[model samples]
Target: MSARETFTDRWMTAMSHAHRLLLKASRGQLGATLGPMKVVELHTIGRRSGKMRSAMLSAPIVEDGRYILIASKGGDDRDPFWFSNLVANPDVELTVGGVTLLMRARVADAEEKAALWPRVTAAYGGYSRYQEKTARDIPVVICEPR
Candidate 1:
């Protein structure tokens, strides 16, 4: 990995750990939400390693019992590793508001993304900025109860 990628990975790992710690320490009273978005702990089987991996991510949009995730990776050129993992294994576990649920994940198709993009950007303008920063198209991931 390049130095910047390494740093980004390390920073993301550290933030996930800290977010989990906050949720645990607060007994789900705190850290359950980020601004208007809810925090979800997503667990997916690692694509190559076959081990379970977890990431703390904010769901910018949730509608019709589905959680929408943006694989922006802070606008990195490459998609997030967790996105790859889920693509390899669609079955996933999601913890939201201290409750865990089994969910299936998929990348939204072009039409879906086109429709959801506006809502996502409205929810968090940072996402628009993230997209502008990268050449690769950011993916919109949908997670629904399995």
Candidate 2:
């Protein structure tokens, strides 16, 4: 792993551990927060273990009854593990602001991403930076009520 990737992996691992603890303590009421952005917990079935796994994520765009997730992996070249899990099994559960719902996830096509990218970057400028730092086309995932 490159220095950047190593750093990000460690940071994200620590954050995920803390976030998991906080979610348990608060009944999913509280966790990571930043600049008015919405934080959510995504529940997915592990592809290899067939067990449930949870990851804390930021939802920069939630509109028209859908939630948007950016699979930037902290600008790393590879997608996040949660992204792979969701792709392997689209059935998911999302908890936002202490409210949980059953949802299905789909990766946005190029056209859909083209439309949403501007708004996503507008919501949080870091996304643009993330894109610049990575060679992969960061995926945009839409999660709608199931």
Candidate 3:
């Protein structure tokens, strides 16, 4: 679901509508978004177990063909389920549209965070609000194409 269309959202139809809209723009495929941010399927090894975990997320493109993703988990008090998995294993596969690629992942540092967060928040405004609800700083993971 998109940021505006959470599982707990009041308007279920709105969420469905959005998913449909995206699918159509994508021609029933992936990577069909407005701009800067693209939908990518990320596969990461589980932190506790070695099993693979997957999720589709929109990450903003930053410098050097890298992407910035937040572990907001829809503003939950805890980090996203995938966050620790990435920490334990930063190497990941990204399926963007029809292209499957490898991306080395690392949580952005203070300077990088300062530079990238605004770009991310601009693409998805909810991220700023997500930060406001949590005490811990939200992490921005950079996925560099490899």
Candidate 4:
């Protein structure tokens, strides 16, 4: 298989299995296998239709009691569509560590971004590579509990 195909296979196998486990149980055995990494659910409003939508995400850690999510889109050239949704509506609902909270998201200021970006990205290694793959700066949103 080609290198790209191999990468695609690995991604498919891991995500599909994880997704299945999530549907079956709120906290699955894989959570234990993956250390502090946990699946997060984000609820956002559609930018065009204003309809509500939810997506499952993998996060590394929570810092200072705040939730952080990167708009990586798995290193795609385009920012995730959800990113635009957040841009249109900063308020979001998120489930983290099995708890749900309403949060207001604001794109981090550059100074704050400089300090927090490294810490957040280091917590999840793939984030750095994702940033490298895209020309645009991947946004890191700080979601404060509301």
Score every model by TM-score: 0.98, 0.87, 0.76, 0.77
Q: Give Cα distance to truth, residue 80, candidate 3, Å.
A: 0.7
Tens-digit lDDT track of model 1 for 56-117: 99999987889999999999999999999999999999999878889999999999999999
Residue 136 of model 4, lDDT score: 83
lDDT of 2 at 40: 85
TM-score: the better of candidates 1 and 4: 1
**Candidate 1: lDDT of 46?**
95
For model 4, residues 1-146, the per-residue Cα lDDT tens digits are 67875675467447745674765585554443234565667788989999986666665557676777777777766666667898899899986555678998778788877888777677777889988887888888788887
Tell me the TM-score of model 2.
0.87
Best by TM-score: 1
Q: After superposition, how far is residue 112 of candidate 2 from its true place, in Å?
A: 0.7
lDDT (Cα, tens digit) per residue for candidate 3, span 1-146: 66644553434335435654676587756444536667666789998889987666678664567767788776766666677888889998876665777888899899989988888888988889989987879999988887
Clashing pairs in 4: none
Please list the residue runs of candidate 2 whose C-alpha ends up more than 4 Å from where it truly belongs after superposition: 1-7, 22-33
Ranking the candidates on TM-score from highest down gives 1, 2, 4, 3
Give the C-alpha miss distance for residue 116 in model 1, angstroms.
Answer: 0.4
Which stretches in model 3 have alpha-carbon errors above 4 Å? 1-31, 34-36
The C-alpha local distance difference test score for the whole of candidate 4 amounts to 0.72
Q: Which residue pairs clash in candidate 3?
A: none
